[model samples]
Target: MSKPYFDPDFDNLLERINGPTCRVCIDNESMEDCTVVKVDSVNKQGLLLEVVQVLTELNLTISKSYISSDAGWFMDVFHVKDEHGNKLTDQKLINYIQQGIGTTRETPSSAKAKTYTNKVFRPERNGYTTIEMSGTDRPGLFSEISAALAYLHCNIVEAHAWSHNDRLACVAYITDQSADTPIDDPGRLADIEEHLTMVLRATTAPSTSGNQANQQEVKTAGFLQGSEDQGTMTNVERRLHQLMLSVRDFDGPSGPPNLPAVTPTGSEESDEEGRRTVVMIESCDEKGYSIVSIDCRDRPRLMFDTVCTLTDMQYVIFHASISSGGGYAFQEYFIRHLDGRALSTESEKERVIKCLEAAIERRVCEGVRVELCADNRAGLLSDITRVLRENGLTVVRADVATQGEKAVNALYVKDISGNEVDMEFVESMKREMGPIVLHVRNETNGRSSLPPRSSRFSLGDMLKSQIDRFNSLTAL
Candidate 1:
């Protein structure tokens, strides 16, 4: 086989080998009604989500938490309680958690085979190149697409993606980095499409080479074997030292950096006008990264949306803090462009804030109506409708039709409360629904589902109630 594509700088192999390991200890002597769970682990991508997922699966509710990460190591302490608000005394459960987090798993390669369609490229009114892609969804699909764009040195200004039933669609506003202009050249546009298509079609499986595996094992053992330098500093101290070195590099001006001026928006301060989501972006001189702070009401999938938006825009998060209490979430992220520079213009900063604001607004608003066509199956309609309900959506009208094995579904839906569905919600629905359609199509030998027909209806009281609550919150 051809040598696998490898970039030491990009892959950060050493970092992966030394990825976070977890240790969980229960504090029996804590003076509280809840159990105290102490976790120490090496931090990596999706660390928070993993921890939260485990706790949630265990049916543990976190009453309070203290989370911090320095360099690659993180220490999190959570005050948790069982469903009855009692301290957890189950030894087996505690042991299960301890073992669950102690081992590291290899990160999966991004290359995967996916089907793409509705490929389109056009010039936006804002003098930016717009690229829209729709295709079958899989894990790491977004990363692969972003990687393709980065390879072409494209600067993404605005992006939105949605996935439903395993189908995914994304619309990105980007500009050519080298030219700093719209990608109007037909040749360049074709080249971009070709490269993106290749990425989408590529398939990669994990290496099975014993020798390569042994080499990785040896490297890991060496780290644990210890050295004289390891004796001089504790692990936490070493991590802090590494963090300091990284900060120094970030702060040092390697080029003529154009930094945005800092202006406080007073969004963080409390006012009698109720809770208003505040988004602020300012330059951090010490770290040479832009600190984006958001103070907003907490809700389901809030962090996912915010992080997704930033990731879609090609922002590299170096450090972040997320905390929520009293029905509000406070988040601060230290970030830089993928090229390691701060945003260069006022318009750029504004765009970043605007995107974040839009994300936040969409979380609370009614979503857009969606229409889907797929192969018919038993319980297919119920499955699709269930997904909508689970995602906090209310279907106001439905038109379902079945012609032979093919089915067409048109649903008018809004946020459980009646507000315009956000782009994020639309993309999420598409990602989820795409797979079901694909599976049904295959089972029927590529035949379409029978088209069944339904009728449209007026909004119900539940939707009205949601709208009232939303209005009340916004009024405050």
Candidate 2:
């Protein structure tokens, strides 16, 4: 019989060629529209996600990808570009990508070098305290959080807040106003935690189901507590997803906005024009794999959201083909449980579909996009959110960041009654906050414009060749 595709000897041979460090090769001359990134490394359980995370965090758009890692070695190729659809020509960015996914050195056996975990190396230029909070989500909840932080004299430098199914997860980096450094006082830290916990409890209505108390958690940590030489950091967005999952955010009535119902037999469903999200699952009895297919509107970080969900759900992806074109995304995965079993029961299949649907929906912001840029201050968030609450708008999603002296923020807001936001209100707010500082970007009610029915691309035409190539490489 022919040797298996992932034979041990094949991996040994790769180790000798690539050395002990991960190999990242970039080809800019090959693809005109995108940069081709090739990675070869020893196979690890979570290595796929580690590589994807680096790209996603950089705000790069992955146009196409082929993933294969079943044994001792992993090799993959990705076609990527910036949001503007240009090739990556920045030398600094290219070098960072190399260092982010591979070691600083080609061979690590002899030289003493600073090793990178997950290719993360954060320098200690600024000191800040990291605050993580999760609890019941409510309208105007962010305003309250920011108000409290401002009251504590903390300068909010960066924050990300996500809400799904009446749950909220927030991570904020702040510095003490007095010292411009992380708060290291034990007593002060306890006070901050206690105050935030109380605010969370007060905002949440009494849960008739008696599960409300289980959703609250507050953590405060100093970024300077650890050794400065170690450059380890957590992917905050991934952590937010985990926190939302931990609170059972997927159990809500919202599965995606326009996705149709899916049955246990993996019946495929789409909108009348087939523009909405389409999900289907099929089990390969002979190969012992459960195949998942997803087709939906393409957006930034689309693959990261799905892959992270599958990984967190304890499913291992043996093979996957991902590609996007004409503002639509196509993804297929051959996966199995960590215990090496395919999805057997009907309930198991249904749950997988629902969880994947929920994962997709969590990142789909549904409202008017409002961007705020101003000088950073302790009360900037507090003031901005307060005005939003008072203007009959509710923030559905928010991203707050600080660059040098500027506080740049993006917020998605809808009318309190869930109607389309009045542009008059938006203009009024822009004037109130200074027209030069605030701007209206995009208004997406969880839907993008679909191509005309006659010109719609079919799944078979988009994915068949890629799938065939993957199968050919893995065939014994």
Candidate 3:
């Protein structure tokens, strides 16, 4: 087993000053398909997440990556490309990446991390109030919340909504409608909180059989936050992951009601469309490391999701390799607990596997992609969502943003029964919302576009080859 080169208990200024920091080098000619980015830095918990987060936030695609951290240093190489699958040729973007990825410091230890006293809303210095909520997944939920905010004269500047395992987590950035600034009045903030809380706790419409459980109000919670947990503030997407985990969204019922939830390898058949994400964990006893292997459909921001979960779970990734092709992603990680122990128990392994799966599937939005670009106005979000609800469409995920005078929103919607959206209804929606305002971006069949499992190349073989390469590096 390898060990850290630095002493954890050391306090000498020279030793600290001479310790390793971060260095980033980008190579555009390493390969024709992608740019190669290599980072050498001091090994610290959460460092990997920070690097991945930067790349993800920059909207770059990580086609492949190699990570190794032993002897107190992080050495990683990422093969990345732009959203259009082209090499990052922009010098400005490359420079920004070097600066962004090279400056991440170790997150403070838990004892030094900030603790929150107010669990409701905290006004950010940028003149916006951030509100967070998690609750049971149901149709029209976002509409209800937005309606309440509109009633309170709050304008949602930006918002992200994600649903997984029959649960929902949302982060909305809002400002006072008239003032165009953060709502500083405690009374007004309280009213906002109360109204949202009631909306979240409202019961779902009863089914034909009138099940009392479905009729009962869901147990939900909301909190206002100025920033994410731990020491440094993170992006809103990562904050959503933290919020969902805190609410135990991973432990809830799998998928939407009447939809098959993805499970482990032995029984993941429920999600026939995407073939559920597969996560496996086993101990590399000789190296005192726990190896996590995952195979799932390739999607944007996938690396960020998995790495974020591992960091939050306090797992230190010592080595990892990621590759994607043929519409699927395969990743392998050598990790140890923050306490420097391999995952030792069956329950622990199971929990990590489940959480990792949850992380990956959380953003795997199922439904049709509809994009709206129109002039921004009051009650716009509420009206759009209400129209969806009335048309028998349910939103699985949404991204709302306001840029200057335009409202650019993306909504992934499906039939209320968790089926593909009807093109006819979508057309009607376009006419009602204005044909030029709302457009049907894409219709997803809710299945992997790739061929069947038997027809595709073997994932096990791909994983084994990657593992072999990773092992060779570690051995050297």
- Tens-digit per-residue lDDT, 1-476, candidate 2: 89657765475675646686578889998887889998878766667777887788778999899988776667889999976888898999999888878842222221111122211112245465677777667778788889999898877878888877766778788778767787767677778877887777674343434354554444332322124222233366676676676666665522222211222233443544454676788989888899999887788998988888788777878789999988799999998887899989888777777677767777877567888786665676786776677666677778899888888989887666555666654554454443227778555544543333333233222223333443576585
Best by lDDT: 3
Over 1-476, each residue of candidate 3 has an lDDT whose tens digit, in order, gives 99769864354435434754777889987699899999878777778888887798778899899999899878899999999999999999999899878767644432112235444454564566777777666777887887898889989888888877667788887888887887768787777777888888675544333443343333222333223332122467777787677656666463236333546532443344655467888889999999999988889899998988888787888999999998889999999987899999998888888888788878877667888876676666776776667666677788999889998989887777655565654554555443226667554644433222243333223323433554576589
- Candidate 3 similarity to native, TM-score: 0.81
- What's the CA error at residue 38 for candidate 1, in Å? 3.9
Order the numbered candidates by lDDT, best leading: 3, 2, 1
Candidate 2, which segments miss by more than 4 Å at Cα? 1-21, 104-126, 203-207, 211-234, 253-275, 432-436, 445-476
Residue ranges of candidate 3 with Cα displaced over 4 Å:
1-20, 106-115, 205-234, 252-260, 264-266, 269-276, 431-436, 446-476
Reference-based lDDT, residue 402, model 3 = 89
Candidate 2 achieves a global lDDT of 0.69
Query: Which is the better candidate, 1 or 3, if ranked by TM-score?
Result: 3
Best by TM-score: 3
Clashing pairs in 2: none
Q: Which stretches of candidate 1 lie over 4 Å from their true place?
A: 1-21, 26-37, 43-67, 78-100, 103-105, 109-275, 304-319, 337-344, 358-476
- By TM-score, the candidates rank as 3, 2, 1
